[model samples]
Target: MAKYEAKMKETESSVIEFIETVENPKKREDAYKLLEIFSEATGYEAKMWGPSIIGFGSYHYKYASGHEGDAPLVGFSPRKAKISLYFATGDTEREVILERFGKHTSAKACVYINKVADIDVEVLKELINRSIKFLQETYGS
Candidate 1:
């Protein structure tokens, strides 16, 4: 069997350059704000994850099946339709916070918001911290 490789590994690509390419002015601006927020919250400089995601920190995980990969502890992508917030899944506190996270939609692994103003920044920070803690505890520092 071939060794598994993750496509979204960290890159030397410039995060600021990627954000500048976001055509939507509002989304671009929101991306900048998110960059600041995630940076402050994670205390890690942002890195470009794949082509789109602005990621902070990282962790390695291996499933029971032996699939292993590294992923950002917290990240986001300002897509054309919505901003995707990446956090640790299966976190009970995360679910509770999402209930009061203001206007947004969520998938199993991502929370989607139309813009920064649509959600509570304080709550967002809490989510970032929670995700980092959860990943660290589950996977290791």
Candidate 2:
């Protein structure tokens, strides 16, 4: 296994346990579905990131600020308040997509949506695929 995969498997128990305690079946289901979508979209297997995120692919990165680390290429965690989506890269079309995303808030590189039901799934899928493509083109092994 890849090093990260081993780490993920080693931590799988904690990850699954936290998902069980999240107390929202629908949110949990949405997270699982998002994993499925990302997997198909990226052709990369999903790995548990810590005890919450379901991460797809992997990459090594260094910031201009001197912070550097290896992490999942893209990921998402279904938090109690919202679904947090992480993209290591930025998309210029983000604003256009956000206008169509229904209800969401975004920081520098993450997008938070209250729930899957609150947005258009088709648009979500499009944005997700676009983000994955952007990453692959910009930073691929």
Candidate 3:
């Protein structure tokens, strides 16, 4: 059987240069701030994942279907529409925090924010910590 693969793989692409390409000045600035936040929170240097995401730390995951690969413990993408904050989905605490996370929207895998000022930084830090802790406990560091 063919090997299963993860689409969002880490790469050697320059994270700073990629952030510099963000056309919106505000998004660019937010990207830098997020970079710092995730870095300090994860205690890991950021790396480019796929084409856009800035990821900190990594863990390998294997599923029952035999799909397995390495992925960032936590990450984010500063897209044109909004900033996508990556976290472990299905976390009850994450859900609870999002309810009070100021102005933001969330999906199964990410929380979207228009800007850093739109959400609470302390909550963001908590989300980051929770994500890293969850992934580490679930998949090891």
Q: Candidate 1 clash total?
A: 0
lDDT of 3 by residue, 1-141 (tens): 666566799999999999999999999999999999999888899999999999998998888986788888899999989999999866778898787789998889989999999988998999999888888888886
TM-score of each: 0.97, 0.76, 0.95
lDDT of 1 at 3: 71
Query: Which parts of model 3 are misplaced by more than 4 Å?
Result: none
Error of 1 at 97 (Å): 0.8
- Runs in model 2 lying further than 4 Å from the true structure: 1-18
From the highest TM-score down, the ranking of the candidates is: 1, 3, 2
Q: Per-residue lDDT of 34-133 in model 1, one digit per residue for the tens?
A: 9999999999999999998989999998899988998899999999989999999888889998887899999999999999998999999989999999
Give Cα distance to truth, residue 12, candidate 3, Å. Answer: 0.6
Could you tell me the lDDT of residue 119 within candidate 3?
A: 88
Which of the two candidates, 2 or 3, achieves a greater TM-score against the reference? Answer: 3
lDDT of each residue in 71-137, candidate 2, tens digit only: 6777788888888988755678766777888888888878898777787777777776777667667
**Candidates sorted by lDDT, descending order?**
1, 3, 2
